[model samples]
Target: MTHIYNDPRGFKEDMIEGFVRAHRDRVRRVPNASAVMSSRAPVKGKVALIIGGGSGHYPAFCGLVGEGLADAAVIGDIFTSPSAEQVYRCTKAVEGGAGVVYSFGNYSGDVMHFGLAEMRCESEGIDVRTVLVTDDVASAPPEQREDRRGIAGDLYVFKVAGASAHRGDPLDEVERLARKANDHTRTVGVAFGGCTLPGKSEPLFRVDPGRMEFGLGIHGEPGVSTSELLPAPELARLLVGKLLEEAPPDADGTVALMLNGLGSTKYEELFVLYRYVSELVERAGLRIHHPLVGEYVTSLDMAGCSLTFLWLDEELRELHDAPARTPAMIWEVKR
Candidate 1:
């Protein structure tokens, strides 16, 4: 059960309040809106990269705002999409005249709301584009990849989009790179338990003892299927197998990888899993490029983890290695 809150309805607001306070050096709250912008936003002549979704996924919408990442992030209530007005306000605050690119998970609400804001911005003569992240392999078949939900793959799409924008790439190129990143990425997750909302006494869903839910959603949704819990190494094989089955057609054997914990999973446990995960990827004739193992996107207190693969080309590799300093992630230039 979730604990420590004044009012359940105000959870998102309270969280944002504390977040901006803690990261004041890197981000600032957008006035009169549920959004945050980088301290150096509105960089003239540079495309503005904006990403957003529900508030529960930290370090995603807000934590990603800083140098070399998203210029702004519009946040919404827990597990809900931000309103179009809030998105529009955020766009006005950081457009910078170069154009704006909005990237977010392919959830229906986010697509509709962000699309509205995109239209409004373009109507006012501000160039704006939208790139949806659809990388969850379990949500759709390979023939219908565009219909898959976006899970941990948000990181790859956002990273490429932000790097492209930060390097002063033209708006068209930024949008293209973002789309390419999404196209090359795929993910699958497993849930060991469910998360409870603030002030709730019961979890959104429950997994039976000794069993696990595979392909869990980040918004308290149940997994696509369930099975007996396997040992860490076996679990690692299951995840890697699912991804490799749908590896992108142009996969060049080099991939950017992430083993993301979904809230309650311990970092130590993820490391144990990654040990076998790394080995299996190499055994499959793939080179892991700067693989990450930690929580990048998460459901509040959910016991689960997802693995993501971003098949990289030369350009994507360079962008993935670019320097970025954000509240949640810090990547430095390779010497």
Candidate 2:
């Protein structure tokens, strides 16, 4: 299904080169490293926010590098973790003398690799901290929240960290706010089809014609369960209801929500789904702030979608509304 590539081994490299060429005004390739940094990075006294993960999820680990977002994003092979050396090189290139905060999904490989980089950076007197995103509710039960996988919810966690750091917050404060954002976020997804890796002939997995895989992962892993596909309204209820059940203890009815498409889903279809989602939220007496309906985090070409909710308090709301300009997302105040 993956049709465009000269060689499988060089896919990531080629993609990076093209990305840097296209976004040169806002970002630049990290010298001798598989990473990209904001053009205005190393902001003298600002805490640097570094976010990354495997390739294939566009607008995520790379497209997010810009003003009011991540200072840098390290890239890796498809569905693979970036090397520790790559992370260290990116840190050295972007740290502005304040500190560094590394944030990414909570996967075994990511945790191990990023941890190694963190230790190395700290040894050289760089105050580097990390915040793992664990927001996929279907990956773990409430009693084992720490074991959940990170999915589309990466957006909220990264946004909070970037905004906090952009405002010149100390490393401690940035880390705290990032963690708080992760704690308040939850996501659940389903897959109607699977994605094929570059240079591969077959998809990673397949879904039945009339059924959907619930709680699917972003890395082509199958879902936890499967059921017959329902109409858009029913699907919306299924998603919104699941999130409301796991609302944080202190949730006060206000939330930031995102309905993210995996890939191959039509934009018009997403709007139809949101019509029902918005109604469901109001019916549950929750106020939706800044509802986003589009692909944010994706599993390359997978036909599916996920819904995320960030239970917001005063602080989270302010940061969520902060001005940001990136390749995939842009928010600015109206004059």
Candidate 3:
């Protein structure tokens, strides 16, 4: 299918220009790149949290940049990794004396490029740590869990890491908290229909009428299975069942649930799915601290959703509830 923006190479540049122009006060365009450092820089003693990836994942990499999320987000073309230089510049732009924490989904290209950027920061006397998020259960078996791809769970890590930084946690502690969040989280997604790239007139993948792709990735990748579309309640049961089996919620455990729309899904549909997910969790005798239902992360205009559950202890719960003011997320401070 032909896309409107046939020039994929210019995708990042075009997006950055438009994004900064529309949200000038909230975002500052990093010079000569698709990176944008948050206008509300963390205090000098607070650690900085940086996340970046290709541009198609809207709020995932860029929209999450604000007071409560990432301090800086580097952008790349559609489903492409940002250059090491882009990552380095963003790191330099947002780093405070305390240090910087780099968090992103577990993609080989992202890991290699961001890894190089970390080394660059180290060489320049800037402290930095990396946390790779591998929360997608469909990508790997339990024994090879670390090989799983990172998906919406990255948002949970960002929330935890951002709150840690806000509390003036040391760089090491911040990184530790982010890693802990990653370890405690798991996600699974299903797509009703694939998204068409910006310029493309056709979608990358097509779902048979009334069918859904289960365990699909954000980039229109193949799923574990495709089956007839189920009602919201039944679909929720399937998704929640998979997550619970993988990481069962403790009877008294406080959990943070994210019912994220890939892009094209409507809010009403998400709430419907949330309704069932909430019921299932409560049925399992688990407490959901904050049930987030929206498009916290996305995959272009894909018509699907993902569910992420983060089992939280006292410390993680407090951190997760901490006030954050980002374009995409805002909440009360947890005192």
Candidate 4:
């Protein structure tokens, strides 16, 4: 039972229309497409960063548009990839003459469509490079890690990519840093309930009362494990333990920790969980840097959350703490 809009097919268009209006001060729609670029996009002489993904994740591909973030974002239907034509149109708006780097979660449809856009750019002489994010540790085994799905860890990929471009790094360097961000990040999540897309009377999946699904997808896809919902502290220990087992960082190293709500979880609940999450990180002998707790990425109305750790080396730490001015995020350089 979704209570959001008029028509299902027209839902995405309407949402985008309203989004640009509300954020007009910061973003503008690309002519003839659903892409939205920063009001100050095309920062000539600097590399442009264009990010895209399916709709439904607010403050993601759209809200992330602004200075020091993505230059433009291509919009697709709810959980659906945008067409090559739509992505192609984005190049015209965000191309800053240096080049454009298209980065996004490593989903099948996104790969196909964005790949098409990559070829399109080559034909038109617009230098566009693609960097796919694969950071969801639960989606694949370490040996096949490259095949994993990209989840909330995408924020680090976009942030580092955007920061690199903002600093006028060459396209090659930007792509390298974007991939490095992906390599340095890992995420694992759980879902307590499922989400219902617009015009649907039922959720995509279901969980019994007092039970939960582990490693669930953002689109309501089931996870690798399921069990009764545990208390906040226990849940925190479980999540941190799983992530560390997957890829343990240096005991004395620092990491950027993010506790993200999957759309329906409350900030209060997340804070309670963060208390224990913080303790575990310190006990693990790792210092948490710029630990963020909020709804940065989400599933439609799924009552769940995910934990992400971007293992920070010197360069990653510097770029991550750098200033970023976007519709949904802004930070002054701490220098």
Q: Where does model 4 exceed 4 Å of error?
A: 248-252, 333-335
Per-residue C-alpha lDDT of model 2 across residues 1-335, encoded as one tens digit per residue: 67999899999999999999988888999999999999998799999999998998887889998899899999999999999999999999999999999999999998998899999999999999999999998999989988999999999999999999998899999999999999999999999999999989899999999999999899999999999998999999999999999999989899899999998876888899999999999999999888889989988999999999999998988888899988767876342
TM-scores of the candidates in the order shown: 0.98, 0.98, 0.94, 0.97
lDDT of 4 by residue, 1-335 (tens): 46989999999899999999988999999999989999998788999999989988887889999888899999999888999999999888779789889999989999999999889898889888888888888898888888999889989999999999998899999999998888888999999988899989899988899998889887678888899899998999989998888654442388899999988899999999999999998998888898889988888888999999998888888889888888787866444
Q: Given candidate 2, what's the lDDT at residue 222?
A: 91
lDDT of 2: 0.93
What clash pairs does model 2 have? Answer: none
Better of 1 and 4 by TM-score: 1
Candidate 1 lands at a TM-score of: 0.98
Off by over 4 Å in 1: 333-335
For residue 316, model 4's alpha carbon misses the true position, in angstroms, by: 0.6
The candidates, ranked best first by lDDT, are: 2, 1, 4, 3
Question: Which sections of candidate 2 miss by over 4 Å?
Answer: 333-335
Candidate 3 residue-wise lDDT, 1-335, digit = tens: 32445366676677787778877777788776678877877457778999988778878888888886789888887888999998988877778888899999999999999999999899999988999998998888877878999999999998899889888889889999999899889999999988887666789899999999889898778578999999998998999898888764442366789899998899999988888999998898778877888887788888999999898887888889888776655677444
Error of 4 at 71 (Å): 0.4
| Candidate 1 structure quality by residue, lDDT tens digits, 81-117 | 9999999999999999999999999999999999999
Superposed by TM-score, candidate 4 places the C-alpha of residue 232 at a distance from the truth, in angstroms, of 1.1
